[model samples]
Target: MEFDMVAAALRQDAADVATYARVLTVTLADVLPPGSVTVEYERSLGDRLKGREGHPSRIVVRLGERTLSLTGGHRPVAEVHHEVRGVVLSRDQVSLDVWVQALARELVAQAEADARAAEALRRLVTGA
Candidate 1:
């Protein structure tokens, strides 16, 4: 019964995260140029949520070829789980307004790096 109760709570959390993800996506959409970025939300479902198994619900932020996945599930404690490419960071909170600002900065940095690399390649190719 206790497990069931906790699972139910977690499921609710996942749904809440989904709602937050949608709104966050909208805000991100406004900041990122069309087609430059994408946000995805995943929901938890079915009968069981074993440990951290089911609360995988989260939002994915993709900027060009780089990606960041953020989640707030059990153990997140209003804080969030954040993953940048291969790096996983725990005890983070997506609830903070700073999260979005950080994301924007990182995305912009990635775009700038890509642009610089492309320009360098072009110059090399043209022998300029």
Candidate 2:
């Protein structure tokens, strides 16, 4: 988890969104509990034609039965899926900036309470 890199990518306008998404997924997967997050990879048509390896294309984070997913690309948006009663509900087109800020805040809160999380976050912010 390159914590400093993730923060830089999120802040810099010229940063690659795909790379940001990938790094974010990796860091969250490390800090969060196991099996809570998953990532999918795919090659674009051009990449496939050129025989390049697939890149991370989707990331999903599950909290109980509800899930939040984001697509990795030039412009990323978040979608939330959950069930109520017997019906499945979905909220689409959530702003990526808002979603990330919420996650960042949650991570900070967790860091404040847990020594391990604090260390992970410390590494993330300081790149140590």
Candidate 3:
């Protein structure tokens, strides 16, 4: 993920919106599975502007039966929500925490996989 890309996407000016959208599209392409990421932006509502005063943006990622959503504006609390239906799961906060932990574990697993692949390639080149 590029800091410039994220920074650009978080910019405030109208002229910057296209640049930001391009950056966001590229960034999402890098992290998201094929055909799984959706990005959208909308003008600030009057009520929202009374307190926040900026455009609202959203990024949604769908992975089979699970969906992860992230929404943000010029506000402090950027909302994040996740839902996993079609599975036997508890409808409680504990389940939500468990899902969060599972996602973290999956990220760690991917990192480990990348490390192992890199080591193997290094060993092959060095004949180690």
* Best candidate (score: lDDT): 2
- Give the TM-score (vs. native) of candidate 3: 0.35
Q: Deviation in angstroms for 9 in model 1?
A: 27
lDDT of 2 by residue, 1-128 (tens): 34344445345422344655555556444566667667777878998898986777777766544566777666776776674653668665677665555455555655666677777766666655
Q: After superposition, how far is residue 63 of candidate 1 from its true place, in Å?
A: 1.4
- Model 3 clash count equals 0
User: Model 1 TM-score?
Assistant: 0.34
TM-score of each: 0.34, 0.62, 0.35
| Root-mean-square deviation of candidate 3 | 11.5
How many steric clashes does model 2 contain? 1
lDDT of 3 at 102: 39
Q: Rank the candidates by TM-score, best first.
A: 2, 3, 1
Give lDDT tens digits, candidate 3, residues 1-128.
22232223233212233333343355323333467656666656874667753443665545544454444444321223444564523322233233334333332333345655334323322435
